[model samples]
Target chain A: MPTTLIGLDGVPYGLITSYAEKGYLPNIASLIARGEIVQMESTIPDVSSTAWSSVITGANPGEHGVFGFFDIDRQTGRLCFPQFSDIHVSPFWEGKKAAAINIPQTYPARIENGLMVSGFVSPTVEKAVSPAGWLEKVRELDYRIDVDSSLAQESMEKFLDDLYAVLDSRMRLFRETRDAEKWDIYYFVFTGTDRINHFLFDAWDDESSEYHKPFVDYYRKVDECVGEILSTLKPEEKIYIHSDHGFCPLEKEFYVNRWLVEKGYLEFATDSPALITDMSPSSKAFSLDPGRIYINAKDRFPNGSVGTGDREKIKAEITEKIMRLESDSVCPVARVADGCEVFWGPVSSRGPDLVFLGRRGIDIKSLVAVDGLFGKRIFRGMHTQDDAFLIAGQKENLPSPFHVSRIASLVV
Target chain B: MEYLDYLENKSIYVIRESYARFKNMALLWSMGKDSTTLLHLCMKAFMGKIPFPVIHIDTGFKFPEMYEFRDRTARRLGLDLIVAENRLAKYRGMGPNKAGASKLECCNALKTESLQQIVAKLKIQSLLVGIRRDEHGIRAKERYFSARDESFKWNYTDQTAEPWDYYRSLERDGTHFRVHPILHMTEADIWRYISREKLEVIDLYFAKGGKRYRSIGCAPCCEPVESSASTIYEIILEIESSKTAERAGRAQDKEDAYTMQKLRSLGYM
Candidate 1:
């Protein structure tokens, strides 16, 4: 079967379901009627890069060895962002001929049984696509692989312009390239939803807010792209519309490492280095973005004092402390998943000791030298679990919280 | 009169100003089209003989033709050239192809640290580079004239804004400024300038067999794109008509979301 999967990053079932219910997203509404709509569970850290890697390869974070967006190199103790080459297992469609575009973290564009055009986080458009000349074709369609994100943070008008521009060019390129090539499977992702949601999500429901129009306007553009992709679907072809993860709004930053310091777990001598990885040798624990807590075990960090045998005990203590620690202004940390259970793979040891899940309104930072526990965020949106939407054409019954890797099966 | 002419005039003006502002100023020549073109602009700005020397940080992994071009061009132009290499690091087995390190680490060990070493030793108050805003996302965030601390770290978040070409060149005694003479030029404008000036481009740029180098870096770290445009006119047509990023073939930028930003922060051009 020639399946088409369109990934809408950071969109939840509630927004799509409600909007589709009201006729705002007609294609999605129709897909729900004829297909299965289920909420999906993204990877534990729930970062876009790792989530998309899981979606590409049917393996979990442990199996794939991609734990988070950025990982700490166990040997060098350096903060390293994982790339396409870092993927441990062969991608799900490794052998099959496929066409994938605008998928994040698939940089240095992989050349396998088909074409791949890596999107955001890709260094250059030339290296962003495979088979060489397809890059020219993508550019010819006026596609912008990476949006000028500074505009989104600085100016709303420019942000909307850039959002629509990317959508239009992406739609044109996807359609043009889909017909231009023949493949067993064609996959595309619309990231503007995630970008727009981050900046204008608070104004999404507020009609009086200045950002309300741009919010709905961007969604309408996404809806139009989905509709266009749907309208061109072959009679025998079935499309899978889904999101990597769900979106939530965050008002304040939760400084996890600072909290760890407050609890006397992590220590620093001279705070010359600004990052968590630069902590002093005696430091027992540290944190990374999106609330990942790592115990600086002897073997893990260069000069870590905590031993491997004591890993479990330290993790347990940190988990309890993190769960109990909360600020009045910040949303409480609801659930903490042990890193051992959360991450499993050859490189899983490099992952954090605990993966902290914040309440809806909370977000985590990896700051080691923060001024205080409470800090306002420049951007408003964040990632949430159990909010990802997956609509498949198969008649088989699916679980409400379908796994992200399950979509990898439909790609082939 | 043309876009290229406007860009060239702006670059010439910027180059002259940097020469006037700092007694210790040098242009970084990477032996690539952009830097080679910048060299030609320097020759034009200084009336056939650049007053200051040129610096080229050799990572020891460059294409053989690059070294040839560097020596030949310097000799022919009667220019003072200083070739720098981190031989100690390379001898100790530090390379882009080395295992256990990410792309950016290799770049820092070979490029950024090497440049910083030379800059501090030479005490160059300002270094002129041929960086354009459209090259990469990180480059887009830069000003025409950027400053770096004693450690060669660029404070990207707290960068000062420039109005009417007023570059804030003042910095602490140990600190230095990076004067970008071609920050406003586009990739197309660069090709146009090269074509108009009749500058000699490296042979790697012209297509041979089936591939051509778009952005030249170290041999192990750089890859070539598929292009049939062997001549200057064909290259110009290929570039102006296509939207592929020029530095896409360069491998260092793929390390992460902020690899280039980190490299620039650590003092890599």
Candidate 2:
């Protein structure tokens, strides 16, 4: 029997424990009861692309060189959105047949064996799946490779409706593919769980929240899907149910760029959309998504100011400052490690010098169009540092303090 | 020295390359500024006459002026025009008027399905489309010359690489390709080119009662955004200051999270 890995993209462990405690998710509760649970840890930034790659390749961000959805080339000072093709190492199931579906950051879909339907951020539809024949089979089911959730900015109702429709279609696709293919390993990921949390997470805590029932109802559907998929697995086959990272209700959006400007570490040439290269010559440091700080060392950037001897001082100072940060709606920063400290291998020089992690509820951002620290937020949920857990029935040689990357090897 | 000239030159380069590469080629004319600009580039590419046919995947629900302008321009330019529609699909119940499902369903039925049928019917090996990267998030990741399988499915992630003005491997064994002459151009570039070429445009783009269609699809799904731009120059100025994305007014894209991706995969224009 083949191992089946069911990834609930961003459904937190805490959410699952609570839902199971209340008997809302009996299937998940039963899995926790049987499978050995390992508190799975995500990457430093805990982005979908990097975390998923880690799980696929059985390596750290240091080894795989995918820090986030995007990467900045230190040589040219140009930013590049890295894709699945950028993964240096082959996946754990290399040369083995596996049916992979809807996994985020796996676009430009590739597999040595088996079929792959690339998930989010795919550029085109034809290339998202391999062996051109599989394209129509997936298309006929009205299967969408991704959801254009940008519409949610204006209409939440349409967003929710589409999410539900996608969920139902996903279940249909899963069963269709499962029955059709004979594979050694099967993998499927659902991104709707993350999208729902981003929009209606406030409802999770507040029963009176307007979309409360819809939110809970969505989980119930997820629960039903889990049960259906799990029941199909044979007694000998193993199952792994997990999420990439946890989530908490978001309140204030903290603009780290604004903080840098206020502290006189960064100076902008102009406003509007602030690019990293827009920093003035006198600027000492700049940053990118999810709290990545790069010290503008002498000769490093075109407008580099900070020297070699002064980098550690600058990194230490900013680390302390960001760590102590707290405001009315924002919680205190939990961990503020240097980028080099967080990621290792060849990506150190190309990566950030400082990586900061803030507590959940305060959404973190690098760009600031306005001259302020706090800003308006459209989203209600934010990624938390305390990531979710992974439960698997196979109990051979598990790392006592295992990371999520090890999950791929456990099945192999 | 003008930016518009550089844009025209680049677009002309793409158009010439597409013409030289593929045999069974056609161009898409949406009767909008982007596709109209593409036509202008096509004329320039072949020196005053386009050798290939221009295709318009008509849904039969466009603005009246669109039809009028399309006919007027097609006659004026002496274009080898071919209008493709899935009338059978429409007769079998499509369009927003036949609403039980989403407007997206109608799009899939009437627009995407129709185009796929027409292309296969013509045995079109390639199409010269006017898709810009800035139009939608899904479009942002498209290749200059994108291939679709026999099923007309676009693989967004698994696309071919373009290196130094060279798009490798002109044809595939079991797939057709779409050639985007203006994939790199922005919304602002289209207006600038329209001004430079003195091209005729759909009147819906200009402000009427303090609003204009930033993006034109079908009459029912398209909405006009608040604008004061009355001329091409003013529209360029609007593009410079506009905060909203060009496709924000297109309703079908917002029907679900991935409607655009799904539509594009199914060969929707």
Candidate 3:
């Protein structure tokens, strides 16, 4: 049977259940009644870049070797965004007749069997699609990879309108593609969910907020899209709906590198350090975005002091010390693990030495130029490891807990 | 890297990572072929010197040769050995023959509980377990870094994904992780590694009267399989051709199909 997999980035299980129960999402409610929604665990350093890779490959980071949204060069200690090419393993659709539309980290798309369209990071629609001829059709449909996220900071009305516009064009593209092509698997993703969550998560529960109604309407439209897609599928066809990760209302942004500085674990050569590569000779450790800490081992980094023998001692000391850190009488640092413990495989040595998971509502960052240990930025929502939901097409009693790594099995 | 080099590097990376992550961590040394291989990897990872204590959960029912090998290896490697035994349980004479007790109960009271007590006393945040997925069906479901609650209950129901080497080493209150460095290595890989590295193992693994223990545990529970493999080379050759399960000779595994799952869910390393 042909399979259809739908991805709604950053949609939480609780939100779907609650909204469906409240009659705000009748389509999703029918799926819930017909089958069931199970909470799925996302990848560590939970982000689209890592989680989507897992979903496509059906393999863990140790096997696929893509650790985060950004990876550090082992020799240079310079930061670089990891692309789909950086992924070590071929996706499940390697030899299948599949159409993967708008999946993140898949820029400069390639599909040997069927159609391919890259996601948000893709520069333009022209460059995002393979088989170059699809470009003209995509442009004709006004197909946009993502909503202009910066518009939220400028004007909420324009941002909301753009969100609806992009989602509308996405649905149109889905219809145009699905009806025109014959494939064994059709994978479509809505990145607008994550964008709306990042800027308007607080508006979701707060009825008094101006954007609350618009937020609910955005999801209501998604439900309509899902219903429409289901209507086109044959009775014997399979369907699976899931998200990369869940979302939570952001409380405070924890600047991890600043905290490291306060604890004397990191030192910057300049008072206004711009990046991790600017660390001074005395610097023992440094962190990248989303709380990935790497030790500046003398054997590895150019300006380093901590030797290979001292990595364990230093990591343990940091783990203990980081647990004691408290902000507003609450511990934001949830868990800390050494690099090898979190990652393995050939390229794992290029990964961070320690992975720090923040508690819910606390967004962690590793920007070296932050002024304080904690602060609020433009984001009103944060990514969470738990609470992502999956509604399997041919539901059965799964032998193990659901995770993004196993999501590929649902369709491919 | 070569296949053996790959396995060695992965194991060394895990060993180093766990040591760095958990300051109060220790390696579980069962004096078995797998754990002894793990011990060698630990020394290699830490630059010819093991930085942490190596624990041996003594059930007091081990073979004499196993004990001899343990002491000899510990002294030779200069390892900080901790012989963790439930002296109270041993003193109370708990064994398979205990009244109304099944082999499972004896194992829980002795092996599992002994490991639990040592972990609690030492406040170990992480424990290096030498388990391979190829060894059991349930172990095949385990993560490289698996977590257990304060009461030492393995939450096999809700394991997080480990994609591209990023393991879910989330720190929760009163939760400890079981780091499995060799989980990906197969039985054949282990023997091949042993042969290549020339690592020493207990003599029991070699054929004794055309019989050898494929997997070792407590003396009463473990049995030898019919094999004429007298050296590491022969063992490697045997592993390539042998279709028998590795734990077939262990009575504990034969108790029931789900017995290991049940034991593991209750934190049996």
Q: State which candidate has the highest DockQ.
A: 1
State which candidate, 1 or 3, has the greater lDDT.
3
Kindly report which residue stretches of model 2 are placed more than 4 angstroms away from their true locations once superposed. Answer: A298-305, A324-326, A329-331, A394-401, B1-269
TM-score, first chain, each model: 0.94, 0.92, 0.95
Task: Write model 3 residue lDDT over B108-213, tens digit each, in one string.
Answer: 9899899999998998889999999778756755778999988888866466545446666766878899999998788888988888888888888899898999
Chain B TM-score, one value per candidate, order as shown:
0.87, 0.87, 0.88
Residue B44 displacement in candidate 1 (angstroms): 73
- Tens-digit per-residue lDDT, A1-412, candidate 1: 7778888988988788878887877777888898879888888888777789889877777656776656676555666667786675556554346788888778768754578888767767777888786777777877787556667546778877888888878888877877765566788898888877777677767789988877876787788888888887888887888898888777766777778888888877665556666678888887776677778888777678899898888888887766666477443787898877777654465567788888887777666656787676456777886689899865658877898878876554
Which pairs of residues collide in candidate 1?
Answer: A62-A344
Better-scoring candidate (lDDT), 1 or 2 = 1
Interface RMSD of 1: 23.1
lDDT, residue B1, model 3:
38
lDDT of 2 by residue, A1-412 (tens): 5789999987877788788888888888888777666666777777677788888877767656777665544444544456676674457665356888888878678664578888876766777886667888888888876555665776888888888888888887898888677677898888889888877888985898889888998898888898999889877787888888778888777788889988889887776654655667788887776777789888566467898999999999888777666687344566777766677653345567877677666766776565678775567887765656677755544554457777776676
Question: TM-scores across all candidates?
Answer: 0.61, 0.59, 0.61
Off by over 4 Å in 1: A269-273, A329-331, B1-269
CA deviation > 4 Å runs, candidate 3: A124-126, A302-304, A399-401, B1-4, B7-269
